[model samples]
Target: MAPMAEPVAAAPAPPHFVIVPLPAQGHTIPMADLARLLAERGARASLVVTPVNAARLRGVAGLAARAKLRLEIVEVPFPADSGLPPGVENVDQITDYGHFLPFFLALKELAGPLEAYLRAQAVRPSCVISDWSNSWTAGVARRVGIPRLFFHGPSCFYSLCDINAATHGLQQQDDTERYLVPGMPVRVEVTMGTRPGFLNSAGFEALKDAAMEAMRTADGAVVNTFTDLEDEFIACYEVALGKPVWTLGPFCLCNRDDDAMASRGNKLGIDQSAVTAWLDAMDTDSVIYVNFGSLARKVPKYLYEVGHGLEDSGKPFVWVVKESEVSTPEVQEWLSALEARAAGRGLVVRGWAPQLAILSHRAVGGFVTHCGWNSLLESVAHGVPVVTWPHFSDQFLNERLAVDVLGVGVPIGVTAPVLLFGDEAMRFGRADVARAVSALMDGGEEADERRRRAKVYGEKARRAMEKGGSSYESLTQLIQSFTLQGGKQH
Candidate 1:
């Protein structure tokens, strides 16, 4: 037995990923979930955020600690002179629409500091995962000699349409004229009015051009959607981009417990117990959950129409009204009167709502949504059909996917898209809202069929995130690839 035992090689260190998210609630929430998922999977994940954004993620940080996951929140100073007021680090905090462009462009300033941080690190990151909006990360990754992956928050369907439109171009006569979107797997129609407003701005075009260039240089993309949800579109997108696109989420599902759900996004306007208690008292599949996301700005008239619509539908509901929308005396009085009339049947939350928790509740039968991708995926993951009311940027396309392709939603019949500034004339009224709600919630064969389809999709979404499922396998492969690359670099 004289031969000395062969020494075993130590396992390679876990791959470390530095995640950079755009400072918006919708964008950051899913990215936060991705960081948590990576940490849980035995990788070191660090989220680089501004001061305000870091504060918003405190709950997520706590979740990671309890789970014993290697998740870190790295704070970077938000660039000043962005035209936004002090302490206004996020899109949701911007009071004026004119400041939006300034806020967007100012984020590019982060590249210098981010590069410095990477260079100073004792061990280089295995990869840099940045939101597609943060296009500046591409240069930083290049300078640091690390791989980078873009994270797209929108549906694969919307992304494919965006790419095709940019490639083939659209010929439109006017804002109302409908044109067939070129190069889609399915027939999708769009009106010039429904096109994203950013497309009209020269400044935004420059930024967009940079983002597209960054996408080309990046190693690949990871989307916050499951393969089962958009398999065809994902395949088409991969072919178009000629890069691997990984589908590793319904990231909201990573928050498995009540504590995690309640704290998943922005700060809650009301206590979690209060919302849960209200839902607990309602009958199963009885409450309609209403929210238009954090950044959507609607005038007081729109709020009143929504209020009257919920009252007219005669259904129990929970509606999230941004505090900014009700600052005027007229809107306040109108909301008060509506709340009084619909007492015990409807609840209106004034600011941020525990959206994930509300959607997860059994009492939530349907959702009145603005077709934001995160909201759409959450609704699908919970088996809730929707009344679609899209507002601006990618929302109209997302609505088409929900209503036409998925068959789990009914449109509220806003034929024209509105701008982000809430300056456009109101189109849909109370009656439109009531009709869509009734179509979704009323007990009929059609309504039941919609609910059934939603349930099936929800089940498939959950299954895809479990071990041996499509998303699970994709995530495993993604980490393994990074690990191997990291070892080579070492």
Candidate 2:
């Protein structure tokens, strides 16, 4: 052998990322998608979740393995005295709003176990990407010497407005006053009634402080949005944070196949095939898809109003009713009667339905949604216009983006936000719901325009994630930075 050729150097291992998501459906779904995206991009990504949350990831785990991606699910023990019942590790699982605080604060307990887990790993993660709510990770990242990137689940518009409103003390103003949010790229108005309940709760002040501190110390931020969707807001947010901000999303697109779409979030209550069959039977762009997100708790009156509104609209529809909302016997009877009256025209799914799959269906013309960021993006990505019905938190701000900025949504005329636990006074009844639904689903010039705009944005969203696209480039830059840092350490 001619002086044996010098052994070739093996390629450096791909950068490894540890992702921690707040244990809620809206937060975890996008984070899980991000984890998949990272693994797909030739990186080793692990998702740290509690045992209960791990169960929700089984489908994701299988899909990743099938694709030969280095995606993993790591389990850390949830604190024992978390004030939540056993196996209740997610925000959606909390029936009583009283446990919300304890559930939120309990996330801090994971920092210690998470740090130990990181130390025990054979290959240290190149970076730790965590949810903004899990602010405790800041200390862990600092102690472990791993760079931390905060992953925000909402839009740049919402984040910027929220920060500005809080900084300007707008939350303390009168509930009816319309105050222009300070320091935003656009003129966004907010009212105290529309602010999140947590903003006024003294019990939640500590958690909020910690989250703010974490943002101040974070290496940067990774948001689940595309620049094409929120270009100006993204630029403003980056400046506000005074750090690098990466926009690499509409992460739902990572779920390429039916298996992935159907299994994207928590386990389904109804069979995916059943949902598909129902949709396939309906006319194209004729069905209204209604969902209030995972955490919203609607009283019986609200549920009845929604049911009556859908029934009165006479449009083919699929409504997802939370199991918690139908606990009372009166509500159950009312639901049964409504189902009987609207058998073929309406389908009501109890508990979690395959939301992604349903929205992607051609039959879905419009969505009556709670204006959750994930739900809004999903609707936009699928070219489905929305009837915005914001609940709380950043939802009101998100509604403004969809209705005012994008012009792809019509508001359902609910002006005030309700507490998650409080007995909410019904503001908009069946008439408001029926009017919004009819305006969106029925053939009207405004409705057609809204649909057209949503379709165009949907196309832009898809293109943003393609190779060499804006989001793709951003993700590539982020990964390269991490890889370089990892190489230096080695």
Candidate 3:
């Protein structure tokens, strides 16, 4: 076995922490963020990962030495019968277009590594921080005699609807009622640029049950969004879980330190130099940088249409289209055309782009995104407006947050013909996309007003993460409460 890992910082030999995050990028990024947070707060943490994903985790751990964090990374070996191909446990392993329930057996295989690590620890952990997907880890946490803290990392409005709809019932046919959920008189339209019309769909039930159980059973539950963004929903979570719902998030702070970056240097082996140089060359608020995140399968046709659409619009762009997400000849044609047509006008990154630097860059005026919580939050935190294309999960709600509540984005609905800002849907359309983007960028009238409002919201989000902010207070209080309970490792 690999040498038993040890913590980085010194703080009374701190509480040992074991974190098992979901395998997807969205899940992994937040999990890494939380691990970094715990480490910085004087916690000694052992973040577990499959051998295949160790590199990815390393990228997250980067070599940071904050005052109180000693973070060690442990890689769990893959079992022979996992059925997944060799080196296929990471997020980039496959592009199957569905939920991954079929791999439960493979997932459960981690119990052995998890159990072994617990047995080997010199100082046992006070608690286990886990993701919703790793429900089976509850068994490991229980057996290890540690209280578990499950992180949901979801937006409030979506999470609340997940819980409430489970009890109050949601109707399938009604769009208006979808917005006006039972007991929520103010129509919790949490997504940007879209209606809450599809909450009753079958996609949300398992997630709700799993998340609800995780919160109910754990000592405490944590979310990545802020209290101001979801006060009502957090209250709902607090009540349902019968435990404090600490909203110590947006979870983007993990990347704030050098250690976080250093940990990943040897792991990802990313070729970021070219992308960085290209981005540096772009004029302020000019390049349309893009990436659909790790899990989003890039449909080539849609990629082509997007390229075509951007080309037709006569704008500069940077589109990242994953090879796995696109597998057609026509898409190749579009890409070929894009290569020739978009020399100065566009640059497609093809894989993951450094999101943080991109968002903060003066060149990126907006984001065209799949509305994952992190990406949406990143855009909001940076005051960059968005073109929201919700693919799944709480994304639909996040789309609403951008388009409706925040006024920083517009919905580019993602059904039938993939809608950019203005294309009409069963309800909304391209005129919408173009107009919205135009307004936010330079369009006069309400356009400037909306951008101004968006900047204010972004500032508020910044405040939540600052000293004495809601998230900061919540974090301090959470640690204090646990400390008061004797700070004992179970």
Candidate 4:
């Protein structure tokens, strides 16, 4: 009944570009920032998203709209491994380890569906900006003659250190905690860098390998951290990757004010308002805001130790405790015990907060974080000193940069196996955790000096992201490169 066959017209050039991310808030945010940059250079954006992440893509889409950019969304299905609870369509629902393994696999599995969608788009994209999970897209791009852009939503320094460690084996060896990497600038890539009182644990070897593979296949890479935050390191990174590494972020630059939409996308009714109110009530340098960051797990003992440490320090504090992290009745009750004792002085948040905003608030003096690269940048960007508890990956190096190099934060906790199980490990449980907390809370005169220095760090971060700054210039150059036809390097 259908008149089927017709002569096909010559295909026009592909659409502007398609960005495929790992479908997490961390990955989505940076890609959205890049999409805005692409649009500014007059390139249309086709953001390929999985069904679970579609709402988030739409939420970020609102930001592009404000810039008068027409950003399109194309959907792909999550791999069965994602373990989306029976009928749950949203990526936000899978919060625990029960889903993490599967979700990680799903992110990688999404390559095929995304490739199919890219092939059928109205206009072909010049290149593909693929996130960590979708690194497989690089192969697809090569198959179809488009460039592959691997996105690393963290500091260039972190990536540099990770690759360095993989090459030099920075993991703890027979209780020798720190290791020196052969790269220039006399670099040290400790298993968990302990400059003095601080102990950091950097794990997740599986992920480092995956990232290196992705980078190997891609034409270029993008790191969502400013050049100033990791100057010499990004240069080292250019050598490590054997390609150009563009330093673009703290990618929340183009983020919109649509809290409801962002909350929907993030799937946590993150009561950012309450956080601000708590900050408002505190005196300057009075409150130490504690957040383990999104991916950092709170082992019950560590959580309890943190609570007791805050209480013993006698500092005014607001600890953002997520119900999801506790995940059990016993842990919830234990948390309540801490809550009841410290009722008036401390507030525990039920969900997430606008972290950078909270960190920047006048009343907030210090931050306790998991040392995710984004969290590191936020602390530096806001001039909020840190009590770093690095859980995994390049976070250890970030902690090194924070305390050893910049003097912006102090480190606590050792999660390496020997450190956790050895003779000194039990001591680590008590001494290291409490000491780091106290240093940041300093009742000493040095607190004022630290605060002044922190403010300077924040100002520098602002300048870097502003128009005509190094980060801005890097972004502009990156956009120009992508915008050229024939995909020529020159």
Best-performing candidate as measured by TM-score: 1
lDDT of 3 by residue, 1-490 (tens): 8997897754454455688886666777777777777777766667788766667665554454334358777888766776665666755565442324434446777888888888776656667888866777787888878788887756766666666655675544455422334544246533223333222234645644555565567877778988766676678767855677779876775466334433431232234555557778877766655666666564443455566666655556667766664456766676777779778767776556667666766777768787888888877777777777676556777666667676777666554222221222333333444444454555466656655765676777788888788987887776665554434442
Model 3: worst 10 consecutive residues (lDDT sum): 416-425
Please rank every candidate by lDDT, starting with the best.
1, 2, 4, 3
lDDT of 3 at 123: 56
Task: Give per-model CA RMSD.
Answer: 1.8, 2.1, 6.9, 7.3
The backbone clash count of each candidate, in order, is 0, 0, 36, 3
In terms of TM-score, how similar is model 3 to the real structure? Answer: 0.83
Q: How far off is residue 476 in model 1, in Å?
A: 0.5
Q: What is the C-alpha lDDT of each candidate?
A: 0.89, 0.88, 0.64, 0.67
- Give lDDT for model 2: 0.88
Q: Per-prediction TM-score, please?
A: 0.97, 0.96, 0.83, 0.82
Please list the residue runs of candidate 3 whose C-alpha ends up more than 4 Å from where it truly belongs after superposition: 1-12, 65-69, 97-99, 171-180, 188-212, 257-273, 281-283, 326-330, 415-436, 484-490
In terms of lDDT, model 4 sits at: 0.67
In model 1, state the lDDT of residue 114. 93
Query: Which RMSD does model 4 reach against the true structure?
Result: 7.3
Name the lDDT of candidate 3. Answer: 0.64
List pairs with backbone clashes in candidate 2: none
Clashes (candidate 3): 36
Write the residue-wise lDDT of candidate 1 on 7-107 in tens digits.
99988889999999999999999999999989999999999999999999999999899889999999999988676789989988887778878898889
Cα error of candidate 4 at position 3, Å = 48
